[model samples]
Target: MKTTSTDESSAGGVTPVAPDAATLESEKESMLRQPVAVWATALACVFAFMGIGLVDPILPAIAENLDAGPSQVSLLFTSYFAVTAVMMLVTGAVSSRVGGKRTLLTGLTLIVIFAALAGTSGSVGELVAFRAGWGLGNALFVATALAVIVAVASGGRAVAIILYEAALGLGMACGPLVGAVLGDLNWRGPFFGTAVLMLIALLVLVVKLPSTPVTGERTSFAAPLRALRHGGLFGVSFSALFYNFGFFTVLAYTPFLLDSGEYGIGLVFFGWGSALAVFSVFIAPVFQNRVGAANTTMLTLCGLVAVYVLLGVFHGTPWVVTVLVVVSGALLGVNNTMYTEMAMSVSDNPQPVASAAYNFVRWMGGVIAPFASTELAEKFDPSVPYFTAAAAAVVAVTVMLFTRSAVEVHGPHAV
Candidate 1:
């Protein structure tokens, strides 16, 4: 007679040891305290965040060197995201099939390879192609990394979630300035530098990362497309999209503005970037807990209002502009983190789709910011991008307040 493995009947058991789905979940929850898994998850996050942002601060240089103007430059972000959106839809089930760690490693490797290629590219067209490659790796890494962490992290329940969020906060704060300084060396330097960082990150994951089995029924490709048919999360994703447009427009373009010695935009971005990095450490957990994601989102939107209002009002003053950018960057950090978390908080499958949708929103901004801000600047004034971004952030906040919560977020402390 052949013997049966509990492994065979273990998941969603036909005749489970537990009484119901709730009880089974409780039992599995007991196994979540793994330390190595937490570390691996953090490593992966650093790689992706750094990769995503590494080119940011150098947008001015890229535009000048590539023989592209501002509006045209923004296409870098837009096209990269367009690629990611497609990849995210496909990678979820692939992660389920191959296992999260393997999929993550493969994605990380691709990031390293293409990022180096991005650095070597001699022409604008080639650089753009490399960026598209970056988006592909990013979508794969991000789509699966969170789910892996959630399943594997040790100690407190969902400690991986907190760690993952922290890693993102750190990355958002650092990516742009790193791009700025390294950007002075070569536009390619920061990207290649990111590839180096990713290489180290991969090595760390090799020893530390633990594999997690995908538990739920895999949603088919048609499902995500079908999801677009429903409007709520899709709308929220676009809200994030516009916010990125506003933020990155400032982030990417400010250096150029200040390099001209007029608005002192460079100083503004530097200060703003610093504020974002610092605040991310201090108030993230508290803000999320107290105001809740939606309310905090409202608060962040208010900050954007101040940013563009100041930018539009005082386009010529470096001091005033720098102050505004700093405030904007800090609040943008909060907004990015909160909106991302909130977007997922409302989702039924929070980890994977949340990552996918949030990235989608962020990249949409990237795609639009460079071009739209540049175009708007040409027609009306340089400050138009700020105003446009502000208006969009406001719209997103409004919708979240009125919209049904798509996800119910409870941190480890909820119990």
Candidate 2:
């Protein structure tokens, strides 16, 4: 028997967690079984992501209901991503400390409560303020949920990523339907429904999830930033930011551009979300196991650039646009999964700072994407945003070309 050394004095004398055979075996099985915790965490991720899309089609209606302008309505999106941007580092660190399950529960609770408040707000200021608070909850949940899957899942990092991201795709696939159906009743209905989903997931998580050993201790203030400077972390982080920026810019308005009423919602999400779903399950593994992360990213980047450009030039045909979007979506999922696995694998140290930096970089794109799209629509052709995404994807591929030397096995026992 490998007797693990126990250090009870660490972590504020919170009983030091021993990664024993029994615990490891249990974790190993739980992961394989797709136990409640795995599903719970995935469900939570689905809900969080759905929040991003749910408000999109309804923003105009919401603005009218609240007597707000387009600019003011935009805050609903901005405030959400903004808080998520600022708080991700802290959220990752705190989850590592207290435990992933605990932090997620609290965060989801806040989102439910605050989201309801924002949904009912009578004034633009109130709605924006509460939405920012809602964003705080989203930040905590989204950042840590992935980390939790990575931490506790015993089916290897690839499996963890696949399962978690699969749920995310399912959540996203369902969001527009939920919004379309619920929005017809009232603007607040989706928010309230989301709250119910979160509550149910919280219960499932508490019952099934094991406690995660603290993954990192707070360092002297400067060490985190310094750790992030190593192993091309900065490049990866920025790419994460730009990745989202590029994707969302295209996604936010693609329906307006290509949605000719013939395909309706099913084909739209089926093309976009279903591609992600299929890849997360069937295709993501090819990148990690066979193609290799950086090489896969390069391939995906080329596909994204090509598809966007194709959409720009040939979107008059609905089939052409659908195929292009589906290809883009499939490639996007691969790019994200492989890039994330690569980034985490790059550093030997615990990943809190690295994770934060990565998320911060990605959210920068989310922040910029909408503005870029809106501005391009104002000044250039609407197709400009699609072309801009194509250009950004090209830039990412170029960056990867330079940074390939930095890729290596990130964990000692990595598969």
Give the winner by TM-score: 2
Clashing pairs in 2: 240-362, 241-361, 241-362, 245-365, 345-410
Off by over 4 Å in 1: 1-34, 155-159, 213-216, 226-235, 260-271, 404-415
Which ten-residue region of model 2 has the weakest summed lDDT? 8-17
**Cα lDDT tens digits for candidate 2, 1-415:** 0111235222212211324457545544645676566777887788877777666546656757888655456666667788888787587567756777778888888888887787677888887798889888888787778877766665545567667777777776677667656766787777777777777777777778787766556433343466667756666666666567667865565655554432253356555776777776567654554555667777877888888888778756777776777777787777766767666656644555566667766776776676567567657786787888888888888877776666633321221
TM-score of every model versus the real structure:
0.81, 0.83
lDDT of 1 by residue, 1-415 (tens): 0111267323312211213455434433643445766766676686577665556567767877888876666666766777876787767667766778888988888888888898898877888898889888887887678767765664222244455665775675566657666776777788888889888888888777765566576756544555444455665676677677677677655555555421233334446656765555345445755545556666777778777878877877866776777778678766665655545444444356555655654576666676677778878887777778778777766666664344222211111
Best by lDDT: 2
Which ranges of candidate 2 are over 4 A from the true structure? 1-31, 63-74, 123-125, 212-216, 219-224, 258-267, 314-320, 409-415
Task: Note the Cα lDDT for every prediction shown.
Answer: 0.64, 0.67
The C-alpha RMSD in Å for every predicted model, in order, reads 7.4, 6.5
